[model samples]
Target: MLTGKKTIVFGERDEISATATSACLKAAGAEVVYENTACFV
Candidate 1:
Protein backbone atom coordinates (compact mmCIF):
# COMPACT_ATOMS: atom_id res chain seq x y z
CA MET A 1 0.00 0.00 0.00
CA LEU A 2 2.94 2.30 0.60
CA THR A 3 4.81 2.18 -2.63
CA GLY A 4 7.46 4.81 -3.37
CA LYS A 5 6.59 6.50 -0.08
CA LYS A 6 9.01 7.93 2.43
CA THR A 7 8.50 7.27 6.12
CA ILE A 8 10.21 7.96 9.39
CA VAL A 9 9.80 5.80 12.46
CA PHE A 10 10.70 7.18 15.86
CA GLY A 11 10.92 5.08 18.99
CA GLU A 12 12.81 4.67 22.23
CA ARG A 13 14.43 1.49 20.97
CA ASP A 14 14.40 -0.97 18.08
CA GLU A 15 11.78 -3.47 19.12
CA ILE A 16 10.47 -6.53 17.28
CA SER A 17 7.37 -4.74 16.02
CA ALA A 18 9.43 -1.81 14.77
CA THR A 19 11.70 -4.12 12.84
CA ALA A 20 8.77 -6.00 11.40
CA THR A 21 7.09 -2.78 10.34
CA SER A 22 10.22 -1.61 8.65
CA ALA A 23 10.48 -4.86 6.78
CA CYS A 24 6.86 -4.62 5.71
CA LEU A 25 7.36 -1.07 4.47
CA LYS A 26 10.43 -2.07 2.50
CA ALA A 27 8.55 -4.96 1.00
CA ALA A 28 5.90 -2.51 -0.09
CA GLY A 29 8.61 -0.45 -1.84
CA ALA A 30 8.86 2.39 0.67
CA GLU A 31 11.93 4.26 1.82
CA VAL A 32 11.96 3.87 5.57
CA VAL A 33 14.01 5.99 7.93
CA TYR A 34 14.46 5.25 11.60
CA GLU A 35 15.27 7.58 14.47
CA ASN A 36 15.93 6.69 18.04
CA THR A 37 14.24 8.57 20.86
CA ALA A 38 17.62 9.09 22.55
CA CYS A 39 18.66 11.30 19.65
CA PHE A 40 16.24 13.95 20.86
CA VAL A 41 17.67 13.84 24.37
Candidate 2:
Protein backbone atom coordinates (compact mmCIF):
# COMPACT_ATOMS: atom_id res chain seq x y z
CA MET A 1 0.00 0.00 0.00
CA LEU A 2 0.97 3.66 -0.31
CA THR A 3 0.88 4.40 3.36
CA GLY A 4 2.67 7.53 4.63
CA LYS A 5 2.77 8.86 1.09
CA LYS A 6 1.28 12.22 0.23
CA THR A 7 -0.55 12.70 -3.03
CA ILE A 8 -2.60 15.28 -4.80
CA VAL A 9 -5.75 14.36 -6.68
CA PHE A 10 -6.97 16.48 -9.53
CA GLY A 11 -10.46 15.46 -10.44
CA GLU A 12 -12.03 16.46 -13.70
CA ARG A 13 -14.86 18.89 -13.33
CA ASP A 14 -18.32 17.46 -13.84
CA GLU A 15 -16.99 13.95 -13.61
CA ILE A 16 -16.76 11.08 -11.14
CA SER A 17 -13.28 9.91 -12.02
CA ALA A 18 -11.76 12.03 -9.30
CA THR A 19 -14.10 10.66 -6.71
CA ALA A 20 -13.31 7.12 -7.71
CA THR A 21 -9.60 7.79 -7.87
CA SER A 22 -9.50 9.45 -4.46
CA ALA A 23 -11.49 6.60 -2.93
CA CYS A 24 -9.18 4.00 -4.40
CA LEU A 25 -6.12 5.89 -3.22
CA LYS A 26 -7.49 6.22 0.28
CA ALA A 27 -8.29 2.52 0.34
CA ALA A 28 -4.70 1.82 -0.57
CA GLY A 29 -3.59 3.84 2.51
CA ALA A 30 -2.49 6.86 0.53
CA GLU A 31 -2.83 10.27 2.07
CA VAL A 32 -4.67 12.62 -0.19
CA VAL A 33 -3.08 15.90 0.79
CA TYR A 34 -5.24 17.85 -1.54
CA GLU A 35 -8.21 17.16 -3.81
CA ASN A 36 -9.41 19.50 -6.50
CA THR A 37 -12.08 19.38 -9.16
CA ALA A 38 -11.35 21.58 -12.11
CA CYS A 39 -11.32 21.81 -15.88
CA PHE A 40 -7.80 20.99 -16.89
CA VAL A 41 -6.33 22.72 -19.87
Q: Model 2: which residue pairs collide? A: none
| Model 2 lDDT per residue over 1-41, tens place | 58878889988866756677889899999988888877765
Per-residue lDDT of model 1, residues 1-41, tens digit only = 69988888554444434566677789999988763343333
The candidate that wins on TM-score is 2
Clashing residue pair totals per candidate (backbone < 3 A): 0, 0
User: Can you list the residue pairs that collide in candidate 1?
Assistant: none
TM-score of 1: 0.56
TM-scores, all candidates, are 0.56, 0.67
Q: Score each candidate by Cα lDDT.
A: 0.66, 0.82
lDDT, model 2, position 29: 91
